[model samples]
Target: MNETKEMRLAAINNLIKFISERGRRFFYRERNRMTGEPQTAYLKLKNNRIYFVDAYTSKEVYAYSGYPHDGFSHGGTLWALVCDFSIFVRTGKSSNGKHGYGGLYSGDWGHGDEIQEEIINYAKEIGYLE
Candidate 1:
C-alpha cells in the first residue's frame, strides 16, 4: 500500500489509541545531545509479543514474539519481525550491535521530526505515558 504521510500518521495514531485501550502504556522521550531533537520510543506488549515503533522516524516497525531475556528491555529478542513500508521481514542480526537482534533502516517517513514530536507530546498530554 502506498501510504501518504497523513495516512501513515493516522495509522500510527490509531495504533497508539488501540494500544492505550489495551491498558498498556508505552512511550518514552529522549533528547539527542548533539542535535537536541526529542526522540520518542513507542513500545507495547500484548500476548507476549512486543510491538515497537520509533516515533521520530517511523521508518521501521518491530514485532517480536520470543523469549525476551530482560523483559524486552533490550528492544528485541534473537529474532525480530520488522515492517518497512508495509513489507514484513524477519531478521536475526542486531542492527545496533546488541546481541544479534533488531534491525535498522536508513530513512524516515518525510513528515519531519517536529510532527513526530508533536504526536508524542500530545499523547503525553493525554496521559499516554507511563
Candidate 2:
C-alpha cells in the first residue's frame, strides 16, 4: 500500500483500538422504538467530546465535541473508545444535514464511502461486527 493508504489504515486501527478500550454498548431505545428491533450503539468519551456509533450498521459514526453528559455506563468502554476514534475517519463540513465532524465547520471531511467500508470490513475481521 501507498503512504496515504497505510496512514489511513493505521488511523483506522487506532480508532478501533480506542473504541475497544473505552466504549460502551447500549441498546439505543430511542432508535429501537422506531425500528422495532434493538438498535445497538456504542458511545465513548474523551475529555469533552463524545463519539457515537451504530454498532450493527457501522454507518452512523461521528463525534460531538463539548457534548454534555453527566456520566456513562461502565460496560464496553473499549468499544466506546473505538467509536470515539471514528471522528478522524470522516471529518465533515459544517452543513445543515451533514454528519457532525467533531463539531467543526471546515475540513477535508474525509472519505465517507471508503472509510465507512474500511471500518465495516475491519470491524468484521476483528469480530467486532458479526
lDDT at 130, model 1: 15
The residue ranges of model 1 lying beyond 4 angstroms of the native Cα positions read 1-3, 28-74, 77-130
Candidate 1 per-residue lDDT, tens place, 1-130, comes to 3544334434444545433333222333344333457544444433433355554343233454434332233233212322221222122111231333322221232234655455445534433221
RMSD values, in order shown: 14.9, 14.3
Give stretches of model 2 more than 4 Å off: 1-31, 42-62, 68-83, 90-130
Q: Report the lDDT of model 1 for residue 125.
A: 44
The best candidate in terms of lDDT = 2
Q: What do the candidate models score in CA lDDT, each in turn?
A: 0.36, 0.38
The clash number for model 1 is: 1
